[model samples]
Target: MMAGTPSRNELHEQNRLSWNEATKAHNSHKGDQAKFFREGGSTLFPEEIELLGDITGLSLVHLQCNAGQDTLSLARLGAIVTGVDISDEAIAFAQKLSQESGISANFDRADIFDWFEETATAGKQFDIAFSSYGAVCWISDLNLWAKGISNILKTGGRFVVVDFHPVAMIFDTDWSHKFSYYSRNRKCTQ
Candidate 1:
């Protein structure tokens, strides 16, 4: 580590701030999300839906669930859903959305790694653990992430991650290579 370099916890705190700001900006462009979900709209794609078929009565934990649209969708499908995110703003909005949309779900604000440890120590386990899209890229340690997931899941529980390939991170929106596939322990800022 370099002199005065941010630790992994510091980097994650930075990411939490960034995602909090991003949640506000991202929601600004999407008109009336609560109304949409209230009207039975879902953000889930067909592939993920197929992969998570028949989740009714299952307890599912959504890791890195930003604003919890998919988590609420899972709840609507009769799963007992809990969504966890590091961003407090996102979790607040998710709770509001749950109330407004009349969907029953739990939203917690905590870094996923820490939350996993706390939840696992508290003897909590889920039948399904899910994460999607940009989730893994934010993680600083895949081994910890995997172990955390394992600790929080039931013996036969399923862990599903639907995310973009690392190759996709190499290219910018213009299809030009703009970033390295590896993090190299440095914080990434947008």
Candidate 2:
């Protein structure tokens, strides 16, 4: 390591491992997730999705679509959605949910970077690319990731992101430094 240099992957393996573990945890709790969401549905719906303007026949892509929650959410709004993640277990669970919920969509598991390359080579482009909360920082380079988004999005297509503010990222609620989890804290707020 060079003087004053840090030890971190340009693309962190820690992020990937964490996601893998999260997929496990999510599957362990999968039986309850849909029920939990139904009890307190959000204001977000197809109308909010339509506010982005016409997507009458547009294709949508959601990257890092954990367990396909919001991905199915989008499919319900009429956009044809294909969700990609690196967790096969999560993807399988999502597919099962898709079948049961009657949301027509597809899910696949692949590393995010390779996903970009393969999609491009397949001559695919999306009308909308959506990602929410925490997925961006896990990526190796924001600029490169943005470029991939550009490659994936057609002319006039849009990419949207919603995430917790940086300041909120610090300070673990469980008092654990360097590993803040949100489950218990979000529950307290609710």
Collision pairs in model 2: none
Across 147-170, the per-residue lDDT of candidate 2 in tens digits comes to 888999999889977766655555
- Give candidate 1's error at residue 10 in angstroms: 0.8
**lDDT of candidates 1 onward, in order:** 0.89, 0.70
Which RMSD values do the candidates have, in order? 1.8, 6.9
Clashing residue pairs, candidate 1? none
Instruction: Write model 1 residue lDDT over 23-135, tens digit each, in one string.
Output: 99987888888899888898999888989989999999999999989999989888999999999889999999999899999999998888998999999999999999988
- Per-candidate clashes come to 0, 0
- On lDDT, the candidate that comes out on top is 1
